[model samples]
Target: MKKFVLKPKIYFNEGSMEFLKEIKGSCAFIVSDSVMETLGYLQKTIDYLNETGIESAVFKEVRPDPDVKVIAEGMKKYLETQADTIVALGGGSTIDAAKGIIYSLWQFRKAAGEEFKKPLFIAIPSTSGTGSEVTNFSVITAEGEKVCIVDEWMAPDIAILDSTCIQHVPQSVVADTGIDALVHAIEAYVSTEATHCTDALAEKAVQLIFENLKALYNDASNSCARERIQNASCIAGMAFTNAGLGINHSLAHALGGTFHISHGRSNALLLSAVVEYNANLNSNDSRYASEKYARLAAVLQLPARTYREGTINFMQAVKDLLKSLGIPNRVRELGIDKSKFENKVETMVELALHDRCTPTNPRLPSREDLVGIYQKVF
Candidate 1:
């Protein structure tokens, strides 16, 4: 039997951050990054909590591509604070780190036979990427590999989407994360686990991203565009969380972890190659994936006389979009040493094949196929 689940209570809009003032908890623990602390978002969050007479503590150690040690340390803080609520306030990395902390605490409590109550988890995303707020997935770096941990307990109980938080994001980040959302929609639409419900959400997310990403890139102050893109990110997250992701994420995780590339940028760099690989009618035994790509093209109002034409146009559109955003289409262009990348290709392929996101890929890639795709992008 197939099942669909929607877990989080999402609160969005211009004043969504004020929702923090409604929390009934007496104590709150915030997990975020140094950038957020520097940007005053952490203080802003604490101010809201304070208005409700809630005491709060901040852990500002979350880094890009959070590692196991970081998560462990965050877990320790979480337990030490014994807060009734936990707030994850940053991009994907911060939210994921917060989830990791909560997950570890749950495991520890269960193993020790101690009575424990899961803290009310809240996710306030400062970036319009990763949809980590609503999803029950977290990626942590361990021993130079990206490890994806999935469990229902990792999902935030509440998600806040306030455009004010993303207003100051750099144009480059806007491009990288916006494209990441597009990839999420594309992958979810073509995933073997996709259902009608997931397809609807994914389609809407794709449309929102294609229509507003460029506008936001050109003018970050465009509030309408920012809100739309932010909504699209969460929508795509919902779709992927339910339908599961594909090799696009698998490859991105492996590549990002190995080379210390930014997650969204890595996904952007590998998107076209992965799309072509998945849509290869000759290589893949199933036409379903190609048909889905064609449908996506149609949604974007691209010319689609045939499925192959639609697929080609879609790939070209992706390349064009990346170029317009100043994103490099190839890993070589990203300044990774060719010799170093080549030496690590086998390890990357192994790690990607084992990634939790790979099983739902429309086309199950062989090791050779993965290597070829990496080399093509290289």
Candidate 2:
């Protein structure tokens, strides 16, 4: 049986952060990062929960790429506070760290055969990317490798998309995270496991990204653009969580983890090459991916009279979008020395080949295929 999980009760629109006032729990454990603390987002969340008379214990230890140690540390604090709820209030990393802590707690209690009441999990994203708030996937680093953990119960019970939380975000962050959402939509649309249901969500997400990402990047204060991009991110997350992702994500996880690159920027750099690789236009074969990509191009109302033209148009549109956003089009732009990147090639390739996202790739890539793409990006 194939099951599509759309579990989160998402709250969006103006003043949606007040949903926290409806939170029911003795104490809400908030998982966030230093950035959120500095921006007073952490305080904003606490205040909302406080309105309901719920206590708060803040764990502001999450980092860019949440590692296993920090999750353990957060769990220790979670247990100490005896929090009945968990409010993940930040970007993807903070949300993933919160999910990890909750997952660990579940496993520990199950192993110990102790009765445990599952905490109510709520996610408040401070950025419009990753869709960690709605998806059952979480990435945590262990031993310097990015590991994606997928579980039905790992999805947040509630997702709040409050514009208040995302106001005046930096342009660089807007570009990076917005592009990640675009990648999510594109990858899911062409994933081998994609169903009609997922296609609908992914298509709408693609349209939204194309329409609003540039506007948001140019003017972070554009409330309409901001809300739409956030919606697009969540929609794309819903799409991929149900449809599964592909080699782009696999390669990105490996590349980012291996080099300490920002996840969104890493995905951004690899996107064009991945599209070309998957489309395989040079092979002159009418591939499934080409058709899927063509469908998206058609949705964007690009001049795609045929699948081939559609594929080419799609690739070019993506490149143009990246250029418009000021995202680096080549891996070399990140300043990693050529020799060092080449040296790590084998390690990255192996990790990518074995990544959870690879198997669902429309075209199963071999070592040579992966190597060529990596070198092309360089």
lDDT of each: 0.92, 0.92
Off by over 4 Å in 1: none
Give the per-residue lDDT of model 2 (tens digit) for 213-309.
9998988789999999999999999999998999899999999998899899999999999999999977866589998999999999998898899
For model 1, the local distance difference test gives 0.92
- Residue 90 in candidate 1, Cα distance off native in Å: 0.5
Give candidates' CA RMSD values in order.
Answer: 1.1, 1.1
Listed in order, each prediction's TM-score against the native is 0.98, 0.98
lDDT string for model 1 (1-378, tens) is: 767888999999788999998999889999988888888889999999999999998898998889889988988887788999999999999999999988888888899998778999999999998999999999998888999998988999999999989999999999999988998899999999999999999999999998999999999999999999999999999999999999999999999999988889989988998888888867547778888898888989999888988888888888888888889868998789999999999999999999999999988889999999899989
Count residue pairs with overlapping backbones in model 2.
Answer: 0
